[model samples]
Target: MDAPPDIHSLLAVLDRDEWFSSCASDLKLALVRDARLLRCLAGEAVYRDGESARHALFCVVEGAVRFSSALHDGSPSLLVYLEPCHWFGDISLIDGSPYIRDAIADVDSQILCIPMQSFTQWLDQNPKHWRDIARLSTNKLRVAYQVIGEPGALHHRLARRLWLMAHGFGSRMQNPSLQLSVSQEHLAQMMGSTRQSINAALARLEGLGLLVQGYRSIELCNLENLVNHANRLGGE
Candidate 1:
């Protein structure tokens, strides 16, 4: 296996993307000024539900993190999986409230933790970057709305999610396939469906020749067909 990347090196990678780099620079200047970087092993909880949201927003420099909220009985329902260049804790960071959700490392992860006070101070000092923050916030809201409004069908929801992930992360890969290493249980939680429903949908998609499922990898076999199906579902 390849060696893991350091936090500073991860920051450099985020810096290569114009929008991500600018926001990261502002966040880094505010919080991680001289702070030591931390590492979280796979399956570790970055922040548990109901914990004080004291830390600044966490940027996924490398590896993946899953943001989830507890069900009535305290079982976690995965909301989404975030990878490199994605930031979380925005709601708590903005509202100064305890984190409403729990964040866990899905793999060996490197993240930058900026203090909340420092982030607010930097925002106060530089008003221009706030526009970028606003855009990011708006985009997040749009996604939430789309996901929330989706139909109850598990395959429909999964197809939409795969499309979004492919559009977001596929450019870096040679084939641009959405090969998320997530389990069916996690997918069911994210989609607010049961494991049976998720499995059925995956099977249906495989039958339709739109996806290829291996042990832990799912490849988008036909992007156009997937997009068309997503659009038709959205229109319904």
Candidate 2:
């Protein structure tokens, strides 16, 4: 694992992040200066479902965090993974409510947290900045809607989900990531399908030379082709 990231490195990441890039210069400075770094071990819960909000905004600086909620059967369901440069916890921060899902470190992770007090103070000073936070929440909702609204067979859906993960949802990364630290089981959970079905879907992609599955990871071999497959309007 990599060493914990320092504030300077965190600032560099925030400077390039989509949401932070849109903030006013002064607000950006405040966020970079006031942010605190949190290091979490694998499987550690950063925040639990129904827990009182930390009243802070969070961004994954390094590694990944999983957002999950329990199903009606009392089983935990995987909502999504937040990778580097992805901001979360904004919904609770915006509405002054408890977190609706659990945020856990999927692996050893470095998280940047800007305390709610600092956020509130900044917003109070310039209420217009609230729009930035609203954009954060809405962006996530838009991605979720896209995923839920995708029309296709399992393979098509899987392709889109993989593409989304590699891009950190709506990260707008110039070069999308080639590797994903996700297991077939996690993919199955995300798709609400069985492991056997996920395995079959992965096999289909593999056959098309789109990806290569590792022990618990997947490497995209042809992002262009995969994206084409994902966006294809007709059934395959």
Q: What lDDT would candidate 2 get against the real structure?
A: 0.83
For each candidate, what is the lDDT? Answer: 0.70, 0.83
Taking the tens digit of each residue's C-alpha lDDT, what string does model 2 give over 1-236? Answer: 23434656666777666777777887776675666778899999888889888657888888899888878988668889888888888888888899888899999998887778877887889888788878888888888898986888889989989988887787755647898989888888788888999999999999999999999899999777998998885866
TM-score of 1: 0.82
lDDT of 1 at 139: 66
What are the TM-scores, per candidate, against the unseen true structure?
A: 0.82, 0.92
RMSD of each: 4.3, 2.6
User: Looking at model 2, which ten-residue stretch has the lowest summed lDDT?
Assistant: 1-10
Deviation (Å) of 88 in candidate 2: 0.3
